[model samples]
Structure formats: structure tokens, C-alpha cells
Target: MQVKRFFAADMRQAMKLVRDELGADAAIIGNRRVAGGIELTAALDYPLQPAEPVKPNAALEAELRKTQAIIATAQARLSLPEGLTAKKDCQLFGERLDDFKNDFTGADHVANRVAEPAPEVVGPAPVAPHAYESASQDARGLDIVRSELHGLRELLETQLGSMAWSNMQQRQPNQAFLWRRLQRMGLPATVAHDLLAKVAGIAESQQAWRMLLAHFAQAVDVVRDDPMDEGGVIALVGPAGVGKTTTLSKLAARHVLQHGSQSIAIVSMDSFRIGAQEQLKTLGRILNVPIIPVGADQSLTQALAPLAQKKVVLIDTAGLPAADPAFRLQLEALASRGLRSKNYLALAATSQAQVLKAAWHSYKQCRLAGCVITKADEASTLGEVLGLAIGQRLPIAYFTDGPRIPDDLHRLRAHQLVSRAVSLQLAEEPSEDTMAAMFASFYNDLSRKVG
Candidate 1:
């Protein structure tokens, strides 16, 4: 087999060049549009035995027919006149053709010499998929070869990624470790780098950790204390299955426990779910507080009229996808109706960092007052929630770690939340090898500073 490439101002000129040089025996393997014109890849094949009879297998006969028909159609479509003149600006094309011919014909390798094109022993033009598919043994062998090549490509890519990571680890051990730790917590690269850049000269590992924590603590916006104490209308909003209803119930329960059941009223705007209103009602019954259901057409202002005397009205909104048209429209409807509400995005701690960020971004149209982090007990790492809290500058209003109504809900504390993040790091990681030693050293440095 021999491979060659040709470039021409147009397909007609390229076909003319191919016909004059390689003749009709050359097959156009591939074509692509170039800057000035088009580029074509052509190949020729020479078989050993010329007098051998062609035996077509039953299975491959259909495929070969299809392939031959397509090739024939393409050839007919690109048919050129025999009297066509070659372009005088063929200097560039001639140079490339000569270079490819020299590279193929002048090769010193034994295999290359064997596969060299011969003038008299012209076989079928090189097909995109060779005769391997037509022969059972060759087909099976090529399948194994293709699989091995795929595995080799994956292995190479993995090796390259590892090499790049290794280089970073070697050059900036401290920074790399810190970055990886934050990333493990589900922080985006952009957020992680921004946090790292804020850290100034740190003589000790403890200081570095503390500085980062302090930065994280300061970076997070917190409502501090119970939001219900200062709340009027607080709504829990987020995507589906994020525990919005559960978090809203938890908040309502907490408000009732602190300020009594009479002053608190829980409302469900999630009429989409079959038993969503009932779920909130069940919780409302448990707390002996009024539970109201608001429909899409019903005026929220009118619904809250009876609860006007209540100190806190917690709204439970329908959980929706970020891209859902109803998601933005619901918020707009409330705003247009002059229904004032403080939206607290109920985010699950077990969610990926990007997912949590997306929730925050999507619900920002509602002008989120703060966030309620849920499913804390289910999460192995609080990094995602913590990263989200700090990165979005949205204060952590409440946390619901368990299914317990008021028992699981607690107001977020900056120092305590930061402490939990560090504790999660210690508990989740094994205290073995260099990584464990690094962690131990980090804490020991902090202990010394504390002393």
C-alpha cells in the first residue's frame, strides 16, 4: 500500500492531477476543505497474485456491494474530461506530490520495499476498511488489535494526566496539597485558586490552615442566630430531590420550638407533588402550627392575610430543575404580585460542588437571602457545602443533618461549621503514610499556635 496527499484550487483540478499521475487505479480515501482549496488523501494497493480467483463470502458480499456502489457513485459524481489542462500554478502541488512519492518509494525498510507500489501488478484501490472485514480470521484479529489500540490510547491519556499532576505536586507541595484538599471537598478550581491567592506569608502549616479557614469563615456570609427570629416570610427554594420541603419543615419546627407554635405558620407552594402539601401539613400538625397551601393562581398576599398576625411565615416552594421555565416564572410571579419573601436555597451537602453552585446560581433570580445546608449526616465531606457557602458569599442560615424535625435543624455558626469541615477532613482520611503525616503536622502546628 502507498499513501499520498494532493492539494488543488478545486476538486476538478485535483481529480485531473490524480487521473494523470496515479490514473483511475487511485482511490480517493478522504477529503477535507483547506484554507485556499481542498485536500485529498489517495492510496493505491498492489496484490501478490494476479491470476487468483476472487471468492466473496456470503456475509461480506452485501457489505462489499454497498461499499462498491458508494465508491462507484462518488467516482461518477467526480468524473472529469480527458482533455482537461493542468493548472500552471501546479508548482506547490508538484512539490508535495514529489515529496510523498520520495518518502514512500525511497524508504530503506524491508517491509516498506515489499509493500511498494508496482507498475504492472495493480490490485484494487486501497479501501478505507481493507479486506480484513471480508475474511473471518482477519476480522477477528483486527477486532482484538482495535481493542488493544483503544486501551493504549486510554493508558497514554491517564499517564499524561498523572504526569501533569505529579509535576504540580513536586513543584508546589504545600499549594498542591491545599488545592487537592479543597477540591476533594468539591470546590471548583476557580474558587479554590481564589481562596489560595488570599493566603499571605504563612510560616507554619497550622497558620496556613488557620489562614485558609479564617478566609473561608470570612468568605461565607452567615445570617448568624436563627433567621426565624428576625424573619417575616422565608421561603426554601432549590432543585428537585434537594430536600426543600424537609428543610422548610425543619425550619418551621425550629421556629416553633424557639418562638412557640402560635407565631409561626408554614405554607406549601409545591402543589406539583401529589402529597407535598400533606407532608407539610403532617409536620404542621406535629408542631400544632397552621399549614397553608398556595396554588399557582392564588394570591400569596391573600393567602398570608390570615397569617398576618404570625411572626414567621415559612414558604415551601416546588423543587424544580435549573433550566425549567417554571423555575424563573414562579419567582417572577411572586415578585410581580408584590409578595415579599426571603428565599433560602436548600442545598444538600452530598451534592457535587458544581451542582451546589448551579443551584445557588439558578436560585439567585429569587434574590436568595441565605442557604440552608441539608443532608449533612449523609455527606462524607462538607467541602462542597462549605465551598459553596464561601464562594457564593451566601450566608449559611440553617443546617439539617437528619430526618428529625426540630432536633436536626440548627442555626449555622461560622466557627463551628469551619471546625466540622476540619473534623470531616481528619475523620474521612486515613492516618497512614505521608498524607496522614502531613495532616498530623498541619494540626500539630495549629496546636502549637493555640498553646
Candidate 2:
């Protein structure tokens, strides 16, 4: 019999080499893990030696028969199932052989089992490319199903909302009219719904409308006394380019005209801007008040120490992005208990509702005393800022309509703000689809609470 040895990185590779070099009929006798791979000893034509007959002793014969029976039982238990592929069958056979050797060879052999080939050396069967493609397709199909379900949910909501709105118009026409009127004024559905709830049982449309306007005006909280009149250390805080410096100048000019510039001073923490300090200096020159330019290295407490005698010290903070470390530090300084400074958020009326809201959240860390609505003359509608102030319950201290310094800054008047919002109301009614989409979630929330 011609015998040869084959070496390969894995069992499958070794088996392939054996078949290619020694042909399909070659019989594998011994296999072992070698330096970098496995070694298989295969023979083309293996010789089987016949056993000679022996004279039997009864006791010895009984012991030999019992051992043969145990060997047969173990082989039967380790046999591979017919359903498994040839590759899997080969792997299972090798594992079962190792297990059998470990069990019968005693603890010494089992302890040295680490010398045997690791299971990972054989590796798992390679998954076909089609299997991965199938899985990817399934994931894509699931995403499509989710998207369709979301669209279906929105459609159902819109239809249900249309039906509910129709019912409201038919049952309570007066309330429906007032709700539509509020919507025309550009009020969010949530705020309009809340205001509508206040005049629930009023049957007359005109009276209900009048009462709604009154309630709307009352909802906007304002400072009883103007900041210029009250005169304290006030810091104007907001995002960059919302007119902090301009608003500060306006406040200083107003205070200078009314209370004299001697009692007031301006502290600029806006050193980061290119011409910020210069602008404040120019304003200081015009108003005859001292403009204290606070550098990044200067402590706000140290800067304000000498100005303790001043009645109104307006701080014009740098309009830095909320993410900046300096922005947070400035807010922390203003919020410090010892400073006792009233921080007022400066919001631009021309900004979108979301921008206005974000500005409020960013500056609110300073314990905002109130807000100053800037750029009112440029804004097409006042509803956005009005809604923000009313929703956040932030008192409006002043409103600046123009760049005319003291001429533009006016004390907050609730009725005038409400009337301005009304005058800017949209002339055309909202489309049916628009109204349905807007009120769908609102009506659904109300139904859930009522039910």
C-alpha cells in the first residue's frame, strides 16, 4: 500500500488536497494538528491484517466480549445523521472522535486535550452570497413596511380630524368661528385650543370673540415697571446677532434722557465682536455714561464692583452660540448669586418661532427676569414672539421697533401687543387640508383626555 501525508490550513482544505493528490478512493488513517495546519496520512490501498485464532479461557473471553460491546455502543452514539451535508458530517465525525478519546483515555489524556486542534481551525461552513442578499432584501422590505404604516397612520388621523372639525362647527358654530379666527392670527393650535377652552359656554360669537381677545391680552405677562424706571443692574443675554448691543444702547439712551447718564453705566462683555467695544464706546460718548469693556480674562464681579453705586448697569453680553464654553461661563457669571443682576433675554421679532424658542432656552440658564422684543418694525407678524412669551410665561419688559435709540424702545403694553397681532392676521382663511393637518393631533389629544 502506498501511503502519503497531506498538510493544509484546515480540515476541508486538507480533505481537498487528499482527494486531488491521492484520488477519491484514498483512505485516511491518521490526522493531527501540525505547525500552521493539519496533517493527514492517507493510503491508496491499505492492507488489512487477519487475526489468528486463539484457544479461549472462559473468563478472558467474557471480558473481551464486554469490551467489544462497549466499543460498538460508543460508535453507534457518535454516528452522523444522514440529513447533514458531507462537509458538516465530516466536522461532526472529527468532534465525536475527540470526545470519545477524552472520555475513554482517562483524566491524564483529557488534561492534555489542549494539544488537540481547536474547533475554530475548522471554522463554520461558508455562507453563500445569496444568503446575505436575502437578508439585505428582508431588511429593506421591513423599512418599506414601516414607512407605509406611518403614512397610513397620518392619513387616518387627517380623515378623523376632518370629521371631528365638521362636528365642532355644526354643534358649536360660535366656538368654531373663534378658533378659526385665532388660527388666522397665526396662533399655534395648542395655544388657540387653550384660549378657546376658556370661553367654552359663551353662545354669542361677538361676545365670545371680544372676551377671547381680552383673555389673550391678559395672558401676556409684563413687568409692572419698566426696567429703565426700576433701575437696577440688568444684563441683556441672547444668541449672537439678535441686536444685544443695539438694545443695550437703546436702554442706556432712554435711561440717560430720563434718569440722567450719571446714575447708569454700560458694561460690555462683547469683546469678541470686531467693532462691538467701539460701538459701545461711541454710545457711551453720546450718552455721557461710562462704558466698561469687560475682557474675557476679566471677572464680571470685578468689573461691576466699582459700579455698585450706579442704579442701572446694563450689561451687553456677547451673542455667542449656546455651545461655546464662554457663552455658558458668561451665563454662569450673571447667574451667580452675589451679582444680583437681572438677566433679560433679548429676542428679535423677525426670527422664526423655533429660533425664538431656542434663544429663550439658551439664555434662561441666567434666571431671566424678562425679555425685550427687538426688530418689531421688520417682522411681518408679532404672533410668533407673542406666543413664545405667553407660552413660556416670560414677562415682556420692553419692545424696540426701530434703530432710533430712545425713540424706538417702548414699555410693554399688553393691549397694544394683542392689537398688533390682530392687525397682522392673515386675510385669507386656511385651506381645509391645512386646517385638518394642524388640528389633527390637537383634537386627538383632547378626545383622549375627555374619554
Candidate 3:
């Protein structure tokens, strides 16, 4: 069997690449999302009919010889002085364990054993110290087991998530096609399936897509009431370099535009980076609002005491990884200090699904009320961001597609998001030939239906 891997920005394109190189008979083994796009692995069995096995080519023979030589050299190095090696030790131990198991429960022993129950005997009372020690050990063991189970559960969930798309493709091609349409835009398979399932039995492609988008729009939750309208403390939290400060500045500027700069106050908790405060301060200077810098030792409440009377207070947090120990500490400090703020995770549209998921999971500790998608102009696909929001049910607060201060920040509308996602998906299509092939197949089906 010969195997090849193809990578594309989406699944349909990946499948096209696979079909072009491996032919229609190629069996797809696996597929997954990589750094830039999706990867598909397809395999083909060389011998299609009964025949003599093909012999290896000269190049293959040479490669096999080289591989054998490398293996021999590694084996020689791993050999011990007495002929026993690490591999052999493991093999021997496994064999002994198997033998022990067989010996302990042999057929003869089962036949010779009595079936009658034995009389109960009184047992000694457990020692207090031993009982306490046993309890401690059991508690520790239970913790370890729970941790392992949790890891296993996450692994299983990821695997199951991957299978959802493929299973839908196999079971219901038409519904799966609609599902992939949403998936191509970067939505999770499970989310796409759930949406598609709602509009079942729709045969026409255009009608299906229309229904899908309409349903998608209903499912999407946008910021109905902007935090700035009736805002207290609104913090922008996300991973590093996701344009958190810029987003905060945009929101602050937007607030200033509507309700004068006097009613708004900008506070910076992003003391980790050298110029984070300066950027917000620069925006503060531009908007004519005070940018209060809160130090590590300073209390957030104390820092914002003067701004208590302000209509809106936008807090800019340090863009740190969710897994960082410091992130939890920051959350703890915010909670302990009674920094009641409506947190909004600043996610970039250019981020992959996993990266967005990580950001969502991490900043969720802040009790994020919603998300604000930034860098929309820079992002080639909005599907990943949209999918993250829909899957997590995170309402989108605002969208900043460009760098324009208050101008670029627009309210999140469901129709606009769906349109952008579809446009991006269509824009990423492969070359003319691939598109022609797809259209030709569609034409043939239409012609047959007419006849």
C-alpha cells in the first residue's frame, strides 16, 4: 500500500488534493487540523488484481539495506556485556508475569478446588495508626486515579470530536455537505451537525445553505446591550498579542465618542509588558481620558476608587497564557478584591480553532461575559472564531476588523458574521481545474435529473 498526505486550508480542498493524486480508489486513513490548515492522509493498494507480488526496485533495496544497517548498529550499541539488553529484560519480565498468572489459575487447580463455602473466622481489630495511614494512602491513590481519568476523558473527547465529521459524511452525505459548509468556515463538527440537524430533509443546496445560515443567526448571541452603555468595570482578557490593548482602546474611544471622555476611565492591569501601559496611555491621551496604571502591589479597588463615579471603566489586563500559574493568581486577586467587572475575552479572528479554544478556556476563569473579535481584516477565515463562540456559547460583543479607533468597532450581527465566514470559505477555494471538476460533476448530476 502506498500512502500520501495532502494539506489544504479546509477539508473539501484537502479531499480534492487527495483525489487528484491518489485517484478515487484511495482510502482516506486520517485527517486533522495543522498550523495553517487541514491535513489528509490517503492510502492506495498497488495490486488491484491477483498476481505475483511485485519485487522491490533498486532504490527500495538500497533504502532497505541502509535501514537494516542502521538498526544493526543501534542494536549493537544497546547490547549489554552478558547478552541481556533492556529490551530483553522487559520481554523476559513480561513472559514471567504471564507464566505466574497461568500457574496461579491452572485448569487442574480449578478442578481440584472445593465449591463449598468456608466457615467465617474472627479477624483482628485494625490498629488506629495503621487505619489512619491506610486512609491517607487511599486518598492519595484516589487523587492520582482521578487525575489519570480526567486526562483520559479529555483525550477521548478530542478523538470523538474528530470522528463526528467523518461519521456525518458517511451516514448522511447531503446533511454532511451542509455541515461541512459551516465547518469549512471554521465551526466545530459537532456544532455544524447540531445546526444542520435542525433543518433536515432540505434537498436544494441554496435552500439548505439559506436555512442553515438563518438557523445559525438565531443560535448566535451578539452583544444586545453594549457594556459601555451601562458599564461598570469591563476588562479585556486574552492571550498575548491578540490586540487586547488596541481593542480596549477602541472600546474606550467608542465610549468616549458617545458619552464624553469625562464619564469614562481607562485602567491598566497589564504591568507585565514594558510598553502595555504606554499604549493604553497613548490612547488615553488621544481620547483625553485618564489612564490609571495599577502596579503589582497596588489594589485594583483602591486604584479605581476615584473612577467609581465614572459611567464606564475599561480595564486592560495582561495578555498571559491561561495555563500560567500567574493567570490564576490574577483571577484570585480580582475576585478577592471585589473587582466586579464584565470581562470580555479579546480574540483575534486569525487564530486557529485550538488557539481560540485555549483562550476561551483560560480566560473563562475571569467569568467572561462575552468576546470581542479583533484583527478581522487580517484574518483570512472567521470560521474558527465563529465556531469557538457558537460551541462555547460565548456571545460576541463587538468586532474590530480594522485599526480605525471608534469607526472599526461595530456591533456583532449574525448575518454579517455568516456572510463573512461564507465569503472567506469561498475565497480560499483551490485553482480553476479543481473548481471546474466540482462544477462538471454538479452539471452532470443536474443533466441526469432533467433527463
Query: Which one wins on TM-score?
Result: 2
Q: Model 1 off-target regions past 4 Å?
A: 1-164, 322-325, 426-451
Model 2 local distance difference test score? 0.74
Query: Residue 439, candidate 1: how far off, in angstroms?
Result: 21
Better of 2 and 3 by lDDT: 2
Q: Please provide, for model 2 over 1-451, each residue's C-alpha lDDT reduced to its tens digit, 9 standing for 90 to 100.
A: 8899999765555777899998999998766666987778999998866866643334333433443444455345334343433223223333433343333343223223422333553656776779666656545544443333333334444544554455556656786788778878877666787788788768888998999999999999988887667777898888888888898888888778877878999988888986988898888888899988886678999999899899889998988888888888989999999998889899898898779989988888799999989998888778788888998999999888999987998885899889988987888887665566655656555445444
Q: Which tens-of-lDDT digit does each residue in 267-356 have in candidate 1?
A: 777888978887877887789988888767786777888888888888888886657787777777555436678888888988987688
Write the residue-wise lDDT of candidate 3 on 1-451 in tens digits: 9988898865556767888898998987755557987777789984445666643334323433443443344334334344453224334333332332343333223322322234455896445678566556545544443333333322322232233323334454676566446645766644665677677778786798888889888878788887788778888888889988888888887777777888988888888987997788778788899989887788788899889899888888887666787778777655553778888888899888778888887777667789999999998778778878887889999888888887888886888887877887744534333322332232233334444
TM-scores of all models?
Answer: 0.58, 0.69, 0.60
Pairwise lDDT winner, candidates 1 and 2: 2
Which candidate has the highest lDDT of all? 2
Note the Cα lDDT for every prediction shown: 0.64, 0.74, 0.67
Error of 1 at 321 (Å): 3.1
Per-residue lDDT for 427 in model 3?
Answer: 41
Give the TM-score comparing model 3 with the true structure, all chains together.
0.60
